[model samples]
Target: MLTVALPKGALLKDSIRLLQSVGLDFSAFLDSGNRQLQIQDPTQTAQGLLVRAQDVPVYVEYGQAQLGIVGFDVLQEKKPQVAQFADLGFGHCRMSVAVPSQSPYRSAMELPPNCRVASKFVHCAHDFFSKIDLPVEIIPLYGSVELGPITGMSEAIVDLVSTGRTLKENGLIELDCLYDSTARLIAHPLSYRLNQYNLEHWLNEISKNSQPLAAKAS
Candidate 1:
């Protein structure tokens, strides 16, 4: 059976909706009382694995899931060896550098070299700084990275910014945006190359039903 890995947070609704458009219903994951992490589609066409957005690529890369849906940011950070099929065009956001509102630094480049930068996305943060030739400590903060700057533990934070509400409420300002992120379809390279479980057809149907990769969701 073809197994799909589904992310568990904000992207869940749109992801399930997209899958439904392709005739695979995995909406059980949306139930208010649904405790099951693994569910088979009612039509028994495929199965869904509910997992953290960050782990979606892990499952697909290891072949635990033949196909998966995840955010582009996670893919950029993880760099998992999986075939990126298409951008599903939802879950729009950006990874940005933020600092306390009163901080002297006006941009990522303005921050002093060797300063501490905190983030849950350490890899993305590192890559961004490396390209700019800034030598800084990338502190890995899995929870509440804004606290790094708030508590004076770090000079800035690299994190996802949606509507900028959280940043505003915390008195943090965006210094620079590393990249915009959207949900994407992914498949195990070997499985995709071999068309295992007739995966190519399903992937094609999904792409056909989704908006063009360049079309952002409003």
Candidate 2:
């Protein structure tokens, strides 16, 4: 049976909607109060596994799932070994550097050498700082990265910003955007080769549906 991993957070609803367009009804998983991670489709041709957004890639890479839907941020941060099949185009956001609005640091370069930078995405932050030649200390935080600047734990933060509202509420402002991200469809390479016909057909259908939605969103 074909298996797909779906992230459980922001992208979940849209992911289910997209899959339903391709004849996969995942509503039971969404509606059921069941805490079970794996849900079987009535047809039994495919199954859906609910997982952490960050772990979706891990499942696909390990062949635990034939396909997975997750955000580009996780792909960038994890750098997992998998073939990215389609940009699902939902869950849009950007990874950015932000600091307290009143801070003197106006740009990436303006940050003093070796200043502490906090983020859940340590590798992404490291690469970005390296490219800009701004040497810094990395202080990893699990959640609420906005607290980094507020508490003086770090001079700046690298985190996903969906809207400016969270930053504004925290008295922080975006310093520079690192990357624009959206959810994407990813597949294990071997699984794609083995299920080539069905997977390609599925992807093409989703892409066709996505164009209109993208236009509407724009």
Candidate 3:
């Protein structure tokens, strides 16, 4: 049976919805009290593995899972051996560099050499700063990165920003956007080669249904 890895959290519901649209049902895993990590979807001849978003690509790249749904942010950091099949287009956000609203550093380039920035995504932060020729000290923070700038722990932060409410509440403002991120469908290259027919069919089905929703004009 085919095995798929799915991120466990806010993206889970949307991931399941997309899979269900392509005839894979994982409603059982959605129950509040359901703690099953592996769920069998008999109707679709597949199994689902619930995993952390950061670990999804690892599972797929190692051939443990034939496919996975994960964020672009994780992919940028990991760069695992997987074929990025389709952009699921949901879970939209931006990876950005943010600083305290009151700071004199208005842009990423305005920072003095060797300034510090905090983030859970250390690799991403490093790459972004390097591209702009900004020498930075990367302080890795697991959570509440917004506080990095507010509390003077770091000069800025590189993190995922959706609504900007968190930054506003923490007295921070985005200095520069690193990348636009969304959930993507990825497959192990070997698995795709081994199960070409089935994998191709699945990819086509998902791509067909995953088109961006049209904007309603005012």
Query: What are the Cα lDDT values of the candidates?
Result: 0.94, 0.88, 0.87
Per-model TM-score versus the true fold: 0.97, 0.95, 0.95
* Candidate ranking (TM-score, best to worst): 1, 2, 3
Candidate 2 residues lying further than 4 Å off, grouped into runs, are: none
lDDT of 2 by residue, 1-218 (tens): 67889999899999998888877777776875768789887777688999999999999999998888999999999999999977777888999999999999888789999999999999999999999998999999999999998988899999999978999999998889999998898988987887743776666777777666566665
Clashes of 3: 0
How many clashes show up per model?
A: 0, 0, 0
At residue 67, what lDDT does model 2 achieve?
A: 85
Rank by lDDT, highest first: 1, 2, 3
Stronger candidate by TM-score (1 vs 3): 1
lDDT of prediction 1: 0.94
> In model 1, how large is the Cα lDDT of residue 182?
88
**Tens digit of per-residue lDDT, candidate 3, span 146-196:** 888777889999999988999999888998999998889999898788774
Q: Candidate 1 — which pairs collide?
A: none
